[model samples]
Target: QGVKVSGKTVTIGAATTHYDVSTDEKLRKACPALAHMASLIGDPAVRHRGTIGGSIANNDPAADYPAALLALGATIITNKREIAADKFFKGLFETALKEGEIITAVSFTAPAKAAYQKFRNPASRYAIVGVFVTKGKDGVRAAVTGAGEDGVFRSKEIEAALAKNFDAAALGGLKVPAKGLMSDIHASADYRANLIAVMAKRAVAAANA
Candidate 1:
């Protein structure tokens, strides 16, 4: 599902990312990983019909939506009520959406600085540690996807560091806890935890650039 702001339109599709028309760069800037993943969502035919809303509502852990949505502090407009991005995503492939509540639209406030850094597995291209950073009205937010087995989560360590210094040097001494990080064939929990710091630093560097 995808919603158009100016025309107040919402559409659903089986494919992902919705590439038939050009996406707003400002929106892309709000969530860079989504912008990057849009190209890989599917082939030309699929790109023509895929929708970001559908993927987000679906909440695929490996998908790119959760990180961007959370980092950008997007608002999920549903039939029942509006939910903040932080509260919208509940777990792997789950959301706050009720049985009959459908997403009407999603709106994100543009950020002054933002970037997405991902360490993709070679075969699947899924992020091992996807970090999305944003400096917005609410301050800095760091969202991590693919590192947590439970689902996407905010990286408070990185956020606190960035909030204090807003630079790569700020992240130099911070350590991301490995407690709940994901581990599998491609990487161990320690590796993913390390990648979180590396990606966060990269994201900060990119944002500053």
Candidate 2:
């Protein structure tokens, strides 16, 4: 399955086991940078078979796809209808995808610049605070995942700062609130909050580079 956005429609295809890149060549062709970026998602087995459609459909709060999808302003395309990435993700392991709604594809306008930074838990390799930043014609958007205890979220504070100045130095003085972040044996809420800043800075540096 894949997602494609055209005009106001965001279409999501149903997930399947097949690992044919040809089926979703449009996604890679349209966004080569993102395609090159996708190669870094996981190990060989994951890249060979793991589907973007499957990833988005799952909407795992700790997964990396949701944050990049949201930050890129991609649309979630389903048989039922198109949903904005911002609206598609509702909460932890939750999305607006209704019953029987199959995601066909996702569409993105391509960012002027974009970058993703993740601090992984050694054991799980899951992001403690994954930050995806995109600078586009509209402005800069920062989507954060894996940090919220309740669900994935956007860092408006970071977005605001980046919008004003798209640089790491711009966020130097900003603070990420520890309230509402995740805490568990792997990491504490404060740790995650601190990572948000660290990852944000790294993401900015990467984008700039």
Clashes of each: 4, 18
**In candidate 1, which residue pairs clash?**
1-54, 15-50, 16-50, 18-50
lDDT of 1 by residue, 1-209 (tens): 44233322222232335573236453353444445546654456656765766877888776666887799888877777888889999999999988988876676765778878888877666677788898876799999988898889998898899886789999999798899888888889899999999999998899898
lDDT of 2 at 151: 72
lDDT of 2 by residue, 54-155 (tens): 877788878887888888888877777888888988887888988888887777786777888888777656677789888988899898888997677889
Which runs of model 1 end up more than 4 angstroms from their true locations?
A: 1-37, 40-46
Candidate topping TM-score: 2
lDDT of 2 at 21: 34
Lowest-sum lDDT 10-residue window in model 2: 14-23
